[model samples]
Structure formats: C-alpha cells, structure tokens
Target: MFNNSIPTFKFLSYRRLQAGSLCPMGCNEDEYLHHISNSCSKIKDVFGHLNNWGFAIISCHSFADRCSWLEKKSSFIINLFCSTIYLSWKNRCEMVFGKTGKSPLSITTEAIGIASSLVICNHQNSGQLVVNQQDLLYKSWHPPPPDWIKFNVDASLLCSYKGGVGGVCHDHRGRLLLAFGRSCVHWDIAHLELLAIKTINEVFKDWMLEYNGIIIEGDNINIIKLIHKKIKAGMEGMEYLSFTKNFNHVICNWVNRDSNKLADLCANYAILSSFD
Candidate 1:
C-alpha cells in the first residue's frame, strides 16, 4: 500500500512527483493546502463558511500556519476550525473519487452542527458545569493482550445515508500498526462494520504481519458475541474463515464507544474519505 513513487504518505515529499507542480484537478499548478482551501475550483466552496466565521481561509500560507492560529483559539472556535477543515478534506475526497454534486451549503451545515456538539461536550467535560455521574462515561482505550494487535472499528452515517467506517490496529504497547478509513454511499452500519473487519484482515494478510494474535474490537456487543461464537465453533463464515484458519490467536471483543474513540475517529474520517 506504500506507494513511494507518488506522495502517498501524508508527509510525502510531493514536489518530486512526475506531475510535478500541477494538480491532478488540472489547475496547472501545485496543489498545496492553500490552493485547496482557496483556489481549487472543486473544493473552494467547502471553505466558504470560514469567511462567514471571520476566518480569512486563504490567508494561511501553509497548513502549519493554520494549525498555529488554531492553537491559540478557544475550544469552541478550534472545534469549528478543525471540523470545517475535516469536512473540506472529505469533500475533496468525494470529488476525487468521482462522487460529486453534493452541496457545499449542506456540508457546511453539518460541520457546524458537529462543531457545536463538540463544544457542548467539551463544556460538560470541562467541569464548569455539573454533568450527571450516571450519564458520564470516562472510557479510555486499553491495551490488548501482551502479544496481540487490536483492531477497533466503527461506522457512522452522516449527511443522510452516506456512511464512513474506520479501523486502527495497535500493538499491546499502543504502537499503531495500521489505520484506514473508507466511505460508502449506504448507511447500513452492520454491513459497514463487517466490511471494515474484512478489509483489516486482508491488510494484515497482505502485510504478512507477525503477531501472536489479532483482536477485533468494536462497540457492537451483539456482533462481538456472534464473531466470538463463530470463531469458537470453527464455523466462522467465509469472510473470516481464512483469518481463523491462518491465525490460531484471534479474538473478538466488545468495547464501549468511548473506549474505542480512535476507531470511532477513524470511522468519522472514513465517512468523509474515499479510500481505505
């Protein structure tokens, strides 16, 4: 999956590519975050709301400069900034993947809603207000068994039926082995979660990963229980049978959504992405 020939990595040295200084969008110019946020005909609309929020979207010379500005902002404003950027990224993915025609205004609305919810949650957790103990959950990601790599997955629907799923694999010491997010047009979460597992399994296989075990974790208790039973009974479906047959140490477990935050974040990322 590591394509060294192009700028596949997020921090890739992209200037050396064959396309050189031209965007794939045919702008005949380098595709930097500045161009993406301001000049790209495909995604310029995605940043329109930034002007309404008093942010000079095109003023930042680089992504790091924007980060520096965001770092000085309040939580509410930071949420808005980060969420808008994330939504814009997702829209870019959609355009690249040829799933276009979505309205920028609608996406802006969703980004605002998500940012407001995050602000509210931050306020509740900030301890300035009394949050009910019964309603508050402080679940944190836990390490897997000593030698296992845990894969946590989550899926959510946004913008009415567009789905995204994401998963991450971390070793016992919390070292990330892999992470992926994918977007789909359907809102069938049950299907999406399972698809995430299958994709993860394939990646592990392709990488020829050396691990004592692979633990699949997610928030769906029923699916967790079912997978566990299938593995135990040696009756795992075709989707997972290859995994069970190849690896003697595989596990399926349920985690609270809070504990699976990384995976959930991946899923959120996926909903706006077009790739694994």
Candidate 2:
C-alpha cells in the first residue's frame, strides 16, 4: 500500500472518483508516498515526532533515499519509524472513509507503543519489509545492541600452519572499535575456530574496565549451539565459553557468513601474514 504503483483513487483516474488523486488536505498534488509520509496536511505531525527522536532519515528527499538511510539504524528504531508511517496511513484511510478520525498525535503515540512492543518482544532479528530502491533490492547488516560493543570473529583453517585467526569489534552503529588478526598453527578446524573466539574474548576481557559487556558473533551455528555444554563433544569451545564470567556479560551468537564478512576478511589477512 505504501508503494507508488498501487491504484489509489488519485492514480486510478476513474472520472467518478476524480477527487481520489487529490489530497483531502487540498495540497493539489497527486497523493503519493511522499504526500502521506512527509507532506499532506492531514498527518504530517508524525514526521515531526520521528525527527525529534533523531531518526536522521525523514529529512531524506525520496522514499528510496529514506529506505537506504534507515538501513544504518537499529531494528527497533526502524520499526518505530515504520509504526509512525503505518499509523499515519491508517488515519488517512479512516478520514477518507468518513469514519471517526484520529489525530496525528494519537497516531504518533500508538507508533511509539508499537516500537516499544517490538523491543519488548525481542524482534531484533525479525525480517524487514523489503522495499525496492530504484530497480534493485538490497539488504544490509544489522547493528549490535544499544550501548553494547560487539565482536565478530572467524578463523581460516589450513593443512599448513598458515591457519589464521581474527576478529573485529564494533559499537552499536557498526563502527569499528577494535580489530586484531594473527597467524596461528592449524590444529583441528574446530580447535582453531575456538581459538579465534578465545582471542576475541580476551580482547573484550582486556576492555572489561572500560565497557559494560560485549556480544560475540561467529558463523558456526553448530558449535555455537553446543558451546555451553559440559560434555566432551564441546571441549574445544566449552573451555572458552566458560570464560564469559570474567566480563560484565558476554553473549555468543551465530551469524550468517555474510554478516561476519569483516572478520572473515581479517582472518584472510592473517593467512597472508603467515607467508610474510
């Protein structure tokens, strides 16, 4: 319904509903995504609330620009923005259908509630509404938790001792805070991978006096699922997982390799270092 292609009354051009394209606010412009979202006299106040809250993308010139800008923000904040737009759209529909109307303030309040619910429900990994930017669709990585530092770690195993381990730590905005890489002897692949986690954990441990805690990520889901086990099958990782208590808190998560690309690149750098 948010896209321009929809046959809103204004776009349909049927003479009986000739007034359809015209905004009820009498903006004299065809009702489009831009009109309902950031313009139009009926529901523009929601944008003000969103902007004051530092969404940093409402000022963008177009729907596509705003979508790309929102890509860099946290999921909670993005849902907050989405809620505002949705509420505004609903209000517009109600008004047009001659139903009792809701003020923009009411809509904004509801949108904020929606955002709060998203956070409370832990919808951090919920799939996003895919919007096309121009002719193409694009998706990007997500940020870490609010006020928490994150570490992405990976290791490249080789039969040769040229095995490498590395990690990149970043803040909630995905800005690089620290990165480290080194050459290491190739043991079993799982053993070497656990060493990479240990190395990154050590980095966070050293910063224990500065930050509150850290969230560590890797692409190995099987081992991550087994990391907290007391059994011997998890021996390679359980040793390092037990070290979490040394910090304020430590969260271990498995990410797709795409999200872990920066750390994978760091690991490759270590492999090259072995030859140097």
Candidate 3:
C-alpha cells in the first residue's frame, strides 16, 4: 500500500517488524507511531505543555489510520499533527544518532516554528498570502503591490597576483543596498560565490522587511547549477548543498558576467579600497 517514492517508510516498517514486540521506548512495530507520539516518557514533559496551545498527540495503528485521522481534522489540527510528527521524528533521530537530548519546551518551540513556516509557505505557493481573516485585514490596511521586487547579487574573484572576493546586491531601481570585498588566502571562485550568498542572506535577515520574492543573480554558472541541481555523494557538493538548503526560500538565478557590471565594480572598489 506504500508508494515507491517513500522508501524510507518501507525501511522503517521492515526494521520495526524485525525488532518484534513494541515497547513505548523500545523496538516494536506496534509502537512505531504511538511510542514516538504519546507513549515516550522521555518527551512526555514537553507534550504536556502543548495541550494549552491546542496540540494533542493521538495514536494510530498504522500510517493509513493516521492519514484517515488527518483527513477528518481541520487545517489547523492537521498542521499541528504534522508539526508534532516532524519534531518527534527529529527528536528520535537526535536521541539515537545525534546524542543530543533537548528539553520538551525546546521541541515544542521548534514544532511551532516549523508549523508556522509550513503554513506560510503553503499559502505563498497557492497564491493566497493571508493565513486567516486577520491576515487579510492586516494586508488590506497596508497593501503591497502584486508585482515582486527583484534584487540581483554577484561576487567577483580577481586572480592575477592578489586574491580576493567581491560581492554586491542592488534593488530594482539600481540602488546599491550592500557591497563589500574580502581577501581570500586561496583564490577559489566557488568558495567566493558561496561566501557572497551567505553574506546576502545575512543582509536580508537584517533588513527586517517582508519581501514578496527575491532573485539572486550570480555569474558563476557552476555555483548556480550546484544550487539548482541535485548533488551526488561526497564532500565536494556538501557546502553548496547546505547553502542552498539554508536559503531555499529565496530564489536564485544565473546571469552573464558582463550583465553584472555594477555589482562587479562595487566588489572591485571594496577590495582596492581595503589596501589604501
């Protein structure tokens, strides 16, 4: 009854059956969902506090049963269930492999954050910006335009004798918002591109404004591909994978080096000015 795309679920089910007998905190197929959701005494303290926020941990005999339960619930309830399930799974992984045991409050807080983000993302994707009636009212009071404002970013690496990286971001009106340069002990174009993306993310966080969308422009085609394409195994792709995962909320694009002149100039200035 399972789909092939969710191979992990199949693996988990097989592992559960082999263990034989389910104890809330021990290996058992019967305990697969229950132990993680409600029966685990280790996380009971955390679950206790979630009731006030209208979160309840329910038990189901199988994944199918869980799906049925979700189908009958309201959207808010469904979101809460998904959030708790994700956090519980995360906690289980951390306990077994990560060797880090977090407090219940921490887990609850994380679950809430994940739930909120999921709701926001789903709404955004459906072209429905408002989560509730209140959100609609709030937007009505201060309406943002339907069109998205785009920002283009680029990083340049100069390799003649001295090694350094330059990064700049500009608004739609061609106004420079961020520009900087830094010396690199080793001249690596890929590394510089990653550094520039990281810097841009930091700047966006500090801006404290909700943007409808963002488009990151870079000259490095490989870096763009790395961010957009799926990575194979090994450390060669890990940094780029991590960076893309971390900033997937923002859209990224690739542009010709010649088309990104203003940002290039800004980066060049930052590097040259640092020496003087």
Best by lDDT: 2
List model 1 lDDT by residue over 133-194, tens digit each: 21222245556777777788888777588888777776665545566777887767788777
Candidate 2: where is the Cα deviation over 4 Å?
1-140, 159-161, 230-243, 274-276
Weakest 10 consecutive residues of candidate 1 by summed lDDT: 1-10
Error of 1 at 174 (Å): 1.2
Q: Write the per-residue lDDT of candidate 2 for residues 1-276, one digit (tens) a residue.
A: 345664455666654545567776567777767666556666556666445434443566777777777788766667777877777767777777888877654565466546644553453355444332200101234566667777788888776767888877666644456666778776677776777887754555555446666688888876676664533354453554555655576677888887777577667767766311
Clashes (backbone N, CA, C under 3 Å), per candidate, total 1, 2, 1
State which candidate has the highest TM-score.
1
Superior by TM-score: candidate 2 or candidate 3 = 2
lDDT of 2: 0.63
Clashes of 1: 1
Q: Which candidate do you rate higher for lDDT, 1 or 3?
A: 1
> Candidate order by TM-score, highest to lowest?
1, 2, 3
Q: Which stretches of candidate 1 lie over 4 Å from their true place?
A: 1-139, 205-208
Cα RMSD (Å) per model? 11.4, 16.2, 17.3
Residue 54 shift from truth in candidate 2, angstroms: 34
- Which one wins by lDDT: 1 or 2? 2
